[model samples]
Target: MAQKRDYYEVLGVDKNATEDQIKKAYRTIAIKYHPDRNPGNKEAEEKFKEAAEAYDVLHDPQKRQQYDQFGFSGPGMGGFGDFGASMNMDDIFSMFGDIFGGRAGFGGFGGSGTRGRQQHRGSDLRLKVRLSLDEIAHGVTKKFKVRKDITCSHCHGTGAEAGSSSEQCPTCHGSGVITHTTQSIFGMMQTQGVCPTCGGEGTVIKNKCKHCGGTGVEKGEEVVEIKIPAGVAEGMVVNVPGKGNAGKRKGVNGDIQVFIEEEPNDTFIRDDNDLIYNLLLDFPTAALGGEVEIPTIEGSKLKVKMEPGTQPGKTLRLRGKGLPAVQGYGRGNGDLVVNVSVYVPKTLSREEKSAIEQFRQSDNFKGDAATKHTIFQKFKNYFS
Candidate 1:
């Protein structure tokens, strides 16, 4: 296989760039040098393909992180590395997303995030759920039905026959390599290639399984339960490890992602960590000052004291509310802001009109104050 290039450098971005920044960078260059835009131009095509590959990896949180840790020599460095390099122009497979865990990267998301050098892992899956504001306030448990490949119960993850066993390959002497001549940058040199007979798999099964057909796996349906934490917000993703497809070999299963989506609230809007809602107050009550009851995320009433002369759109805060921190810090609580909406009367009864007239007759009324300005008197005398 061909060696790969640094993903961060290929995208022309810093390693610390955020997801949005990565997306913007990729879009700008991808549009400019896109294969469609610059058709038949090999260089532009390469650049466009490279940008797409970068986007594929960078858009997914997990893959970008893995790519970050391993520049060009990581476990999956060569997985989709060829697409970014355009090594194989005629190959267009399913999304790398289809491979890894439903997250698409370059050529394909064919592998998993391995802590150390080991066998491959199955794909990961993503599932989205929408919840009401009240559901987000407290915690909830959700059950999911999923279909994935699982280790064959008959074979028990081994492809060998039940009575017989697997023996190491002999052509490559279990090392799975043979000597061959190849042309390199230096010159024609002798190198080791995979054993043609054994396919370089090292081990060969003497008797294959009849049920799994030597694949060591089968497709099945299963149900999984997820715990939605308190204070979870929309657009946030939760990772459930090792819940994806079973590996063909001894490789591990992938992960499952639960994406939280909040249903639009009729009464409130949520900002990052804060809650905003509207409260209506009558004109008299706003001017005279009074207490009011309001709805809260907790499903209980919150009592608030409205200040005298509280203006429309004025905001008041209630502490210790909002979504919980997903990081388990237990230190984040959002403030709830109540927007004051003064209810103006458009039509009034005779009794209400009489009360207003009597109020206009009080000292608070300013009917003749407009004509009693004294600064104008001094200026008038000077002018006369």
Candidate 2:
């Protein structure tokens, strides 16, 4: 296998970097090389894993110090995990928890490492949760399930059948990476790939475990509790640490990402921490002062007074009626915008025409004759 690149070099960070600085670096690199976007591109995946490994050591205060002084997978505290010694990758990942900010299960392996490593990490999982209008109004907790990876009880995650050790990979001779030379415009260029013999894992379990059949993980269900803060808008996401997949070799579990999905209510729409609802009223009711029932997010109705001769696009203020502060911003309510549409009569029945003719006999429909907007004059009288 080619000589492993320096962790700092891989992450493009100096050895004297601080934890926060290291985290910023890792976050940038991780997002850039995330496998979801690259899709089957081996190079990006390799860089992703490499940056992750560097972050695993450098992000933690203690591990960073140890690596700076000792270099290469240093002692596991009690003189464990000596170089060239067999160490469970899952255990290594878990022990280095301080690095990933409690999100270890999301990390994977098999791109570039020394060679011959044991891996076992439960798979990470994602879930979407929905909140009701009232729930978002007052803030609430949502519980959901996630199907994730767990350790196989039968083999204890060893992947070896009963009291047996794994055999050396014959393809790369226990070297997890293989060198491949190809002719390119830039002359003979050399690259590497994960050894197929051991699946980039230097060793192979000759006697596969009956329980796990060689893979050390098992399938399981994860229950997650998500707290939706008051005023949390739709599409907001909450992070629940260590709730993702159970890592292999007892590695730290991944994080559970709670994406907020809100169901649209017939009566309400949310804008940030505020609520909006449309109020429909008859032409006379809007013209004359009256009280109308409007639904609110509090699971009930509110009687709002409309002023006499209210015009189109008029708004009514409902103080403290909107959603509460999600991150403790401020207690505020949204104003209800009432758009007025004049209801026009389709057809006049004989009796309605006679009644209108009888009313026309009176001076009540006088003014605005030139405009023939006599109906509007009656609208003015409603409030009077």
Candidate 3:
């Protein structure tokens, strides 16, 4: 066997390429060489698998670092062996379903062949799920009901009554396709189409099912539970295989696409994975340092220390206290940015007025000439 090509060369990217760049390159290669697009072409299929393997390694930071440092014989090279000969079509499509807009399968190349008699796979179902900031920070499971077509219990997906079964189509002789010959000016041409008698199903039901009227599916509601991953952004889709509408006449069921919708937080604003929290501090606390307890996304109170004479626009960072990375190897948690705002008193009591008058008259309130001049210049700039 020939030695495998370098991963970066296979993906057509540099060693310093970002994750998005690597993924985009792989997507282009995979789509161009997809088996469905180039049917029965062994070279295209091999190229597709090679691109998948390259993406699998380069998109991960740990694997990319190891590959860079130690080459292919690195310590973490367990699954980085021969690429093309190992994976089947299903494995490749299912693993990278996200790149294809949450859809996976190899059926685009359709004609009169062994696959003709098989029923088409059901259509995929999409629904939105709204999650709170806490739920996004930590993964959560959500349950909801959806109305779709399910296999008929009475017919068992055969579209026939309990005692009888489906009969082979007479028009196409169970091939589900009809061929027609036409005479043109140059020569004779043959065209293929679905059999009118069987409607491409290749079977006819004599005793139709009572519940679904020979369709083999019934209107039903199913409660599906989806386990949402942590750090999923809004509009990201989570696919659940075999949870969608049932296929017609024993075909494969489709997938359930769950779209993420993050609810707006009342106290915190999310920016990517990081969370921003605005903290209001009194004038005394700003002048004299104090400890303030703030709430975290994980339902914990964290005491933050304010420095003396802290500015109103000052930001305090709490590292690794935010959402986790959604895909691949985690890039670690984000930060909780605390933005301080000083609150000024609108009204004061008699005791407060007396104290302010005393402080104004004190010697400590009077500064040197240069300091006063600098203060006056700053005030003038602010007004100007």
Candidate 4:
């Protein structure tokens, strides 16, 4: 027997993932490895079973807590049961049937061993939203109108017209699939295909809807409002459920994926949650302590003090002034690092040059005063 992989590892999620996160990950993995999507493949079957087992354990609160502390089988846990021997395809489907909008099978395909064609979820839509640094610092809500396919108002999502309905497909006889047998040297072999009469819907409408022309959907526009959380980074996807194109014949609606694009801040450069600002100080201000006003991300002025002898490349930290953590981890807010740069005069007047020359000749203006002070302090300490 092979060693069982960690539940979190199998689902491609962190151990500290929330229940929603765990379920979302399982849904993605289940769709990818579903048997209908990879028919007659043993590897896919094993992966499907593995995902089911992971979801079964992690979805249960008590089981998850015990699993986290003791792993598969420890003190109180009755061992992570074998998914292959325990769960049949129907069992797995029944457990998570609601994931596929109560279709009772893997998505994009029908239930196992059943030839009926299932309706597929609508395709996901992707769009980019540009947010300013201010908006990222504090959460913002935005609304945008998107054009997509929606169920026809006239027919209420059914292709049939008013006072008329659909009948079972005559070609496949409501089976939704057509099976044919072929003779070969070995013997007769059976093959199945979708019914041509109803196009896998198992029924054919006698009177089609005038609005959608029997498609049961039409182009429409809808306003989608999204609230962007604070501290969101570029390229992060915010999923809006059931906002994409409406599925054919009233199937499940898809998701709207909003990709974040952060606009550059003019006053500060963002690095993770921290903000960096370059502070420029004059020679006199660097030599003599003074206070200067700097712009913050929130369109406010922040007073920063420059200590006497403040040198270039020195960084001043302003705690709790940066953006909050997106995931609520680590310190919630970051610090603002003010990088000091001494400003040098491009051209100096005669009086300015004379004053500088006088300062250069002063007795207390030694170039290595800091070095001498350090040496004297070391000698005094040694004597003590």
Per-model lDDT: 0.69, 0.64, 0.80, 0.79
Q: How accurate is candidate 4 locally (lDDT)?
A: 0.79
Error of 4 at 302 (Å): 3.5
Query: How far off is residue 265 in model 2, in Å?
Result: 1.8
**Which model, 1 or 4, shows the larger lDDT?**
4
Instruction: Compose the digit string of candidate 4's lDDT tens values, residues 115-180.
Output: 555464677788899999999998899998999988889998887799988888888878776666
Residue-level lDDT of model 2, residues 1-384, one tens digit each, is 446678789788888887778878877776687664564588886676667667756765766678788777565422322311223333333333334444433444322222234343344456777777777778888777767777778887767778888777888887765656656322453445567677666777778887767776678775667777877766777777778777654455667777788888777766665567766677668657788887777778888787876655566657667777756555565554434454547788999889778978777445356444655665678768
RMSD of 1: 13.8
Candidate 2 collision pairs: 120-248, 121-248, 230-326
The segments of candidate 4 whose C-alpha lies over 4 angstroms from its true place after superposition are 1-112, 115-117, 175-196, 328-331, 363-366, 369-384
lDDT of 1 by residue, 1-384 (tens): 444456677678888898778877776775577443563498887776676677777877766777778765556655555655533321221222122243233322223311111244678888999988778777788889998988888889886668978777777667654555556333453434446666556667888888888878888987988888877887788878788788775667878889999899997798866788889899988888998988877777887888886766678888866655555745677878788888978999999999999988776544355444654665688799
lDDT of 3 by residue, 39-144 (tens): 5599998899989889878887877888899888977565555545765654455456567643433553132122255465777899899998889988999988
Pairs with steric clashes in candidate 1: 96-108, 96-109, 97-103, 97-104, 100-109, 100-124, 101-124, 231-323, 231-324
What clash count goes with each model? 9, 3, 0, 0
What's model 1's TM-score? 0.61
> What are the per-model C-alpha RMSD values against the true structure?
13.8, 12.6, 14.0, 11.4
TM-score, cand. 3 vs. native: 0.65
Would you list the rank order by lDDT, best first? Answer: 3, 4, 1, 2
| Angstrom error at residue 264, model 2 | 3.6
